[model samples]
Target: MTESVQAWFFLLLAFVGGVSAAAFSFRLLGYLAVSLRRPRDLRRRYGAWAVVTGPTSGIGRSVALKLARKGLNLVLLDLSAANLQETSDMIRSRHGVKTRTVVFDLSLVGTPQGDDSMRRLRAAIDGLDVGVLVNNAGVARPSVAYLHEADVELWVRMLKVNLWALTEVTAAVLPGMVERGRGAVLNMGSASSEAIPSFPLNTIYASTKRYVAKFSRSLYVEYRNKGIDVQCQVTHNQPISRPAFKFHQQE
Candidate 1:
């Protein structure tokens, strides 16, 4: 009996090790493939125009600029008209790519105004050879708070902007890509989606990010063979600006 138990333990260990090794190898290969891909390859596979949400500041702005540099015409969407115009001008000056700006608040989704906003967004992209969609518009509470302590309006807005807006925008754009047989969708996710390092205070934010991750995974599976690549980029927190020296100095 002792010998049989020892054999089963060793077999189980070997099986686990083999599975781990295979998973690691597959990930390594995928990374290598992405690194080797060229800008022209993306243009050929996807198309000429790329749509980016939240293109006013920080990471979203960075992504929009990079796509412009890759020779893709841009459709910039943001809540602030001034910031949208600024980003559009900068991209046009630097990359000389065509740019269109759509300014509307995503947090108002599911309302009559939101429906009108969606109609305007559709009009902005109409007749353009759009190929890439970046669902990057998101929001979080100003400070950490427990579930009961959180503001009800802020929580509702968070859901509206982060999940509902993403769904609606993707739905609006995906059918065109499907008909054309090529496109890519990039969704931004947070590291909080992982099981480790539980977020005690930012519970709602973490849950929303996890939803983005799962939504991207399922979409990828459903559209992989249809020439649409869906990816959820999981990111860790990074300082966007200098830390405030005093509590009153915080922006």
Candidate 2:
């Protein structure tokens, strides 16, 4: 433990931590700027309609509102029919934009009910020009636990929503976007998914989001020539953390 060696070690650690902090800060500031400036003009660039899943609350609600403000008609989906109608009506009243609501639970995406919901979802978006798809529906564990101690069924439901539902929605939306020859898909990811060193307490959840990131990147490359822009946004509850390693995942 010589003084010079210790000095170099501390410097190296600081460099790594600073880089992570810088990335977090950059993403936070960029998001705020985009939200405030509303400079993208998504409707003009994409098409007349956008479909946003889980639109009843949280990030989904915010995204739906912003898209409406940008002058894009909306197709809002959520598990609760009541919530769906509430959000839809609010958006329509506030923005004076057309809104359609569909109640579909992403966690039950493999059952008969889910199949029916899928068909209904397809019918809902059939003829319109869906220029943007926001895969914002998601779920997470109610309580933190190690993998071995986790409840199996709960984890399975999370997977169905996070992976299966998002994938199916993307698949359904892509054909129309391809035919129109222009669109964008935004898949939501979490900070737990390799956005940090690791998410040890939330192992399975992190892995699913990592899959989202990988799936999005591959799709971006696959469809870029086809006029499709697919992007995965990794988010943290706090845009900035005090200690630089407290980035927590959002549901």
Candidate 3:
């Protein structure tokens, strides 16, 4: 290649590298800014006790650690023993906050095991006023050819985990918060609930999330006067480290 062509290539590579470095630096700075501000913000806020379902990883795990660092004792719930123990250990060693792990599948309905699981959780956290409830335990079923082709059992399981289990666990902790006259309920929702144009393949999962949004909103309105705060966040993007599955909107 000619020297001019080589110089041009080198310049182009250098320009691309500079742009990439600048973007990364910007993100790092933004993260640092947020980190610096968070402690001051939490200092102004009262510490609260929290229960986080699906606290083993992803958004649930991040929220648990953040809240724990902000002085909230956590009750971590997940079906996986390894993930649950890892999260508990991280909270204890890093944040020095109390951590409890409960392993229970949220999909089975009207089961003795489910009821017993809740009872044990209540007993373990006995007397600690749970001021925050993060209902994040949800399961997603893979799409078949279409909504009709989706397994009926999968649909039912999704309802059990996303809707029924969320309700049961929230109900278990909420009464105490109401009695104490202060608490927050954060329910994980989805853009699919707002009728987003995701594939209809996941219709059942979307419908269950819609019910969660509606139920959470109604509970918020109903219990606001009793000093309960209910906030529903519609989560859309999963991290790149996870699988890249997309769904179109349902009819």
Best by lDDT: 2
Query: Over 4 Å off in model 1, which ranges?
Result: 1-40, 195-197, 236-251
Q: Of the candidates numbered 1 and 3, which has the greater TM-score value? A: 1
- lDDT string, candidate 1, 38-136, tens digits: 524566668899889998887788888878877889999898999999889999999999999888799988999889889989999898888999887
TM-score of 1: 0.81
Worst 10 residues of 1 by lDDT: 242-251
Give the lDDT of residue 112 in candidate 1: 92
TM-score of 2: 0.80
- Report the number of the highest-TM-score candidate: 1
Displacement of the residue 28 alpha carbon in candidate 1, Å = 6.1
TM-score of each: 0.81, 0.80, 0.74
Provide the lDDT at 221 for model 2: 79
**Per-residue alpha-carbon lDDT of model 3 for 1-251, expressed as tens digits?**
99999999999999999999999999899667755652332212322578899988777877787787778889888888898998899889998888888888887645898888888778866787678788877887744447777777877788889888998888889878777877778787787767475547677877887888788778877887887777676654321111111111111
What tens-digit string does per-residue lDDT give for candidate 2 at 152-178? 899999899989999998998899999
Winner on TM-score (2 vs 3):
2
The lDDT of each candidate is: 0.80, 0.82, 0.74
* Position 115, candidate 3: lDDT: 86
